[model samples]
Target: MANPTGSSLLVIERLLRDRDGIWRQIIEERDLKQLTVQMLTSSALSLALYGAVLGASNGPLQAVSSFVKLPLLFLATLAICLPTLYLFNLVFGAKLSVLQALTLIMVTITVTAVLTLAFAPISLFFLITAQSYPFFKLLNVAILVLTALVGLRFLTAGMTALNDHQLKVASRPPALPPAVELPADKPAAAKENGAVLTAPAPVKRLSDIGGRPGELPPGERPASMTLLYIWILLFGFVGTQLAWTLRPFFGSPDKPFQLFRSIGGTFYADILQTIGRLIGG
Candidate 1:
């Protein structure tokens, strides 16, 4: 058996260096179980480390709480939103299997987690040097939002590629019958019920069907892409609300450490307030 750590490292390297190859594998349904395991392991570890950094602002206990909650936050959001995306795609004729959908989502989460982990050192530097709670909180929020956008971009690209590949395969012409020999005087025409029939026009490539090569015809874009966009928005809203529900990930220095906080205000309201505080001070 191969070492799991080495396998995961190779997976991550491939993710960063050869994302298109990964997408192809996903479309081909290759090594899905192994890919899922590697992605889950790497993302969980990365998010845990970043969560520890977020919690360190308060103390050891909060650090531990954050270390646990951080991974939970992302995974929980995935759990909440995964079903809607999968079902929506299915309703719109997507060829994705449940495992394929899950793996695709894992790709996004892994990218976000890894990017957040990359920003951990900068976050840690501020946690040590910066005293203002609002500044630190907003900075981390900005980082999370930025990384999540990047991950979502990857998700969108993967879905597009998958859809294109499926479309191409579907459009492909099957094996043609052997050409029937005819005398030099005979035309490739036949009389069908007194109506002359000629060989059907050659099938056009998908790229040539539309005005521009490699572009879908006007108003003929897959409904699944629109569904995916809506799902992305839904994912963002759900994640923010869930993060709010699982509050106190970053324990404020002024307040004593608490595992959870009373949920009264909205996440947006809190962000506006934080912005106000930072600007006012």
Candidate 2:
């Protein structure tokens, strides 16, 4: 039997260093359940660790709250948006299965979580050295945004890879029948009025004509990819709003620790308010 620990480690290693292989697995619909489980486990742990750092700015109780909420934030966002992505692809003639879609999104989340974890130490340093709560909030927010962007880039790349693979498969020419041997006595070329006639050169297929590797032909990209890009923007909007809704991740230093805060302002407005406070102070 395969060691579960080793399998999980391998999955994380592949996510970090062999993303192309992961994309291939998703496209091929191989071991999707296993991939999803491993990704979820790794991302949850990473996000929880990062969340602990964010909450550490307040106190231990807030740290525990963040450790729980951070993973919930990402996974909840994924749950909310997963159906839209799958249906969008389905409506646009993409053959992506639900499992495939889930795995792909997991790829995004795992990357984002892992990258955020990598930034945890820096965030912890700021937490210790910087006394201003607003500045610390903005710093962590910036880190999350940067890491999410990188994760979304990976998602775009994976979709592009899937589209290219599909195009190649679709453009493949039908197999021709084996040629019949001609008699030695017969002329290789047809004769018309004692003039030799030859066949015209075979037409080259669009697939046969090559350009730069990994680039799709003009107008060949599916509508699904475009929809996916738009969906990513929607994802950002949804995630930020959700984060605001699940506030108190970084409890204010001035206020007593609370598991949740009253929701009133938009996330962008809050950021602006925080920026103003940061600047004024």
Candidate 3:
């Protein structure tokens, strides 16, 4: 039998093994090069689709319209990406190629209509709310959900890429046995628990990853947690609508000028807001 002290030490190492080493290995194994290509291409395609739909629905545009719309088009496509990624990750724990994943998510969102229902009302409220009370408005939860969804796409692009790698390795010919056995030193039932240490918990020190200490384990999320996040964001924004009154910071009776009425006033308002934003930022 192995030395009692050595066996005990080995047991301790095995206990913390996955949280340290196995997790990092899974993240580093994804197809990063493919992922980068997928993100850029996916973003571009989604943008083109939005611009086309908008242009078709709204009206034919002037020659300069495309140029003016470039940014907005990108923004719309980004909207499509958010919930698509969320639900896609929710349903499938594994990752897919860029186009396959994007299309899959797009279809998923189209079928569920959750993003449509969620965003449309909130968007209408945003427009009306700003027109009604432009100043000192609270950042409600729907807005937060929208904001998080945008941020989430960026977050998950990295996540999907990381998972893609691990899934590939996991799909490979089985290199490790199932967790159904234990080492000889342990009791029969304990041995049946399949004690295999693939590798020592990663040496996560300055010399290991060049990162500071106490960093949380990276990319350690599950599908259910992501769904919970969406549900929370959904409720937060929708809750704002229930508030009976919204206090306004700007109460202008300047003949109730429609923001779309004057080109110069609209332009000036946008610029002032932009400058104010710079200061706030």
Cα lDDT of model 1 by residue, 92-193, tens digit: 655688888899899899999999999999999988898878999999999999999998888988888888886675555545655655446757786657
Better of 1 and 2 by lDDT: 1
Instruction: Put down candidate 2 lDDT per residue, 10-114, tens digits, no spaces.
Output: 566777777787778887887789889988998999999999999998899999999999999999999999999988876766777889888888989988998
Evaluate all candidate structures by whole-model CA lDDT and list the values in order.
0.85, 0.84, 0.36
Stretches of candidate 2 exceeding 4 Å from the true structure: 1-6, 177-223
Instruction: Name the runs in model 3 displaced over 4 angstroms.
Output: 1-26, 62-150, 153-281
> What is the TM-score of each predicted model, taking all chains together?
0.84, 0.83, 0.25
Error of 2 at 75 (Å): 0.5
Best-fitting candidate, measured by lDDT? Answer: 1
Q: Highest TM-score among the candidates is held by which one? A: 1
Q: Quick one: ranking by TM-score, best first? A: 1, 2, 3
The collision pairs in model 2 are none
**Candidate order by lDDT, highest to lowest?**
1, 2, 3
Screening candidate 1 with a backbone cut-off below 3 angstroms (N, C-alpha, C), the clashing residue pairs are none
Scored against the true structure, residue 186 in model 3 reaches a CA lDDT of 58
**Candidate 1: which stretches are off by over 4 Å?**
1-6, 179-223
